[model samples]
Target chain A: MRYAGPAGMDLEKMAVPLENICSQCDYKGTPDCREPECLMGFARRVLSYAVQKGLLDVPGASSLIPKGDFKHYYPEALVPALAETCRQCKECRDNHTPDCVVALVRSSVEYTVLSDSIPYPGSVFMYLARIKEQNPELAALLAGELSKKG
Target chain B: MGDGIFRQKNGMVAIDIVASCGVMTPEQLSGLARLSEECGVFRIKLSTRQTLVAVLDEKGAGRLVESLPGLGLKVSPYGNVVRAVKACAGSSALCPRAVGEALALGIEIQDKYLGMEVPKDFKIAVAGCLRGCTDPYCADLGIVSSGREVFDVSIGGFGGSSKPLHGEVVARRIKREDVFLLIDHVLNRFRALGEPGEKLGRAITRLGLTPFLPPAGVKEAQQAPPDDFVKFLED
Candidate 1:
């Protein structure tokens, strides 16, 4: 199937990157998504989340991640675990489970930032509390690991 | 000392070099390198708007801005003026997929309107095609090539803020010449209506797009929102 449009215009090639970037997402063609009018909105939101979480404080991580938080710094242990969730967010675009923990945390973090109810250190604790409320077993596992390190 | 030099939190001044469409001739590049060396500039940053930024002391900044014009480089205008026009390589031998001459249009726009005072910093971007490599959809005024020498004009797009907006397409498949007239209309309207320090996108958001759009666009805006319960009661 060919798009019989104007000359020297390969609509397919031009449209490929646009389509491929969000093709498998649930919001691929949603009106709210605006045909992916968002050039870097999701990425910005993710970076915002990382900033609020103090994820950029880890050594060697600052160079890779976008700068966000300037005041607070966190321990290095949080990086690998948070990165695993980011990997899930990147991969599970359309295959997201109904109660996906990563999605829940990401949405809650963004909402917290937007609402501006709680400040940073408090917001960090709130994110953890929300995670504990949603997935007690996962929270317990993380708590155990952190206690062991301490 | 010039408007192009902005003082930073670190007590250094950032000098803006208007590298139009991010293009610099080899001679200009060499001149910049020499100037940087002579003026005690330590770092140079490429701004997202296709301008080059050099960090230096206040005295060094004054010297650099003075020397830049000799290398055929212009300093970007500061404070509520149209800055450099951002553009992508359009329809050149290198970029065959482009539907129009984006760089040429960008140059024309910059020549005519750069440094023009408005209510705020007005940004314009041109893309050769739908690929939009230069992110034309995120400019105050955006021109995207729809066909050979034909353009789709959009207004009130913005980015680099907490809230970013995609410019809405107001004119579709218009001729190259009409673009300038459309831009003139938009800029005049924006200047008249916009508050000081308010971005064009914010103005459009605050006041509805009706003032900026054409008659057909106004009609579309009128028809877009569904009649609410309040309207029903009034009726």
Candidate 2:
């Protein structure tokens, strides 16, 4: 599917290695600075790369996530590649996490941050507008997780 | 990374390959493809300036550039050096409107001035005819060949998207043999008179085109067609 967000933002470049994604996602930081760095370490890596390249061209690329985490969110920061990877996962059939840990964990984590009722922290509305376009299944799973938790 | 080389955001170094008048043989293509695989590049991009660009991790760039066969690959890493010359190798039967070989002329220009520094990054293009598929008029200097042995020369073309401007013809119906002489004359004049950082187009605008015209008796001008670009589109 054709995904569009900030102009010139490459999804694969912004994505952390799949194996490295959730190391400490529970710590905090949706699209901004997360404490102790997550397993993926994408936010820090992307920012460092951008600063090194002098590449603050994206619309909201250079903006800093407010200090001290409190429902900090920017759904648009999620890598769209994760959705495509979920489609290829052989374990997701009939909707299960055996082969799709990323899908399950990403949604659950996003859902948790989406509300106190769920299990995570933080709140971001940009993902609501962008997730389905980037990856429908991930968005659906996150919604499903929210519905079940609520 | 040096003068002409720039580091990509992904930490890969982008190496620029100057194509001879945008022409490369299948052997060269296959060779480059093999090199790309060995060097672990993501993809090969065809740049508009008639050059091939490949991004490789910092460790692989030096090795890849070192292996390009002499003459088969000319890497012009950024800076004030002459960029590649773009051209349309006129299809004989398919495009009879073309009288001269734009590609051949482009190669000759490449040999003569591809590395010659003049003022700023001066661009040159050669088109088969008025169709100008290669955007001859948008270059710092350009040639549009019409008859089998004649071309019209234009200067001061700017290709920037923000301020695109078509060059004006300074001479019309120039002989094939004299093309190089005229180009040499233009460059010599530009260097002696142009500001260090000024682009050819901007310099022409500031200094005017009359002073830069081929000196008397060098190449005769036949009324030197008017700024036909603006008129052609508006018409």
Candidate 3:
């Protein structure tokens, strides 16, 4: 299963010590890995690592919700090694990735100020976007918390 | 926090490893790989401008930059500055088709002009022959070698913009020695004419190439190829 998101990468080859949430994703093995920062091409590498580590039959994507201790296992920013993916992307010419929290939050700050949405800041999408930009480390935590509400 | 080091969202710093003319020694490359491992960075990026980029913590970034000079590596200037010269492997006792000293001339240009402040980023490319492996035609200032001793200098080329344009020839069949003088004149003229935030290309487009061209007698006859060039071609 290929978990496609900012934190998604083969567990074995991962340089950082983040939890291998990608191994247990339901969307792992799906073809919808269009997210710019996701390492979708590492399926073989992940499988090899899984086999070696005996991490087969991992849980679904939902089971890995609310990744805790954002500081310890937060999705890292895209490194130059993965820059090839961005080089081939059309969106990167104009719109950067959501995981580019600093740039995104800085731009969103200007957007929020210019639109003057202070009077009617009721959009859930806007809230998530802001949170993701301001503190990507905690955005997943909030998402996990929100999922428990319904 | 300094030149060539950009702070990333993850509180890490990205460092640009300057490899002039896209060339790096084996020792330098090995040093870079070792640095990556020490910093816990597994990947080193090759930037479009022929430099390496690595991401690491602030402390590691500082140490890496400090150690770069020992490995014959340095950082490129960010923002509006003259970038490192781009050149093809021409006539370097290596490339057979090359008729000009591409690497030597590119190094000369880089030593003289790299990191000079400009209104916008300035690019320069040197091609050894008409094959234009360096794509000189698309740089802010371009030099194409017609022969070992002669060159064609073009100005105001622009690429990677919404309105990309090919530069116009300003000096035809100039001598090897005149290239630097012409560059000096171009930079001076650009500084004088360019408006704030205007690129050399945009300014040239609006003002015209007449301002950048060399004196009428300085350039050889436009229609005639130099005798040496014809001889080189025949051989």
- Point to the candidate with the largest lDDT: 1
Instruction: Please give the range of 10 consecutive residues that has the lowest summed lDDT in model 3 chain B.
Output: B225-234
lDDT of 3 by residue, A1-150 (tens): 764422232333332211133444445567743222233222223333333433321112111112221222122332211222122122322222222212222222222222221111223445556656766644455465445422
Give the distance in Å from residue B230's predicted Cα in candidate 3 to where it truly belongs: 13
- Candidate DockQ scores, in order: 0.02, 0.01, 0.01
Model 3 CA deviation exceeding 4 Å by range: A1-150, B215-218, B221-235
Query: How large is the i-RMS for each model, in angstroms?
Result: 21.5, 23.9, 27.9
Q: Look at candidate 1 and tell me the lDDT of residue B45.
A: 98
Docking class of 3: incorrect
Candidate 3 collision pairs: A1-A28, A1-A29, A2-A28, A2-A29, A26-A61
Model 1, residue A62: displacement in angstroms? 49
- Assess candidate 2 and give its lDDT: 0.58
Residue B195, model 3: Cα distance from true site in angstroms: 1.2
RMSD of each: 18.1, 22.3, 21.5
Local accuracy of candidate 1 as per-residue lDDT tens digits, A1-150? 874322222222222322343454455566655311232223333333333332211111112122232212121333323323333342332222212223323332223223221112223344446556655654555455544532
TM-score of each: 0.55, 0.55, 0.55
How well does model 3 score by local distance difference test? 0.58
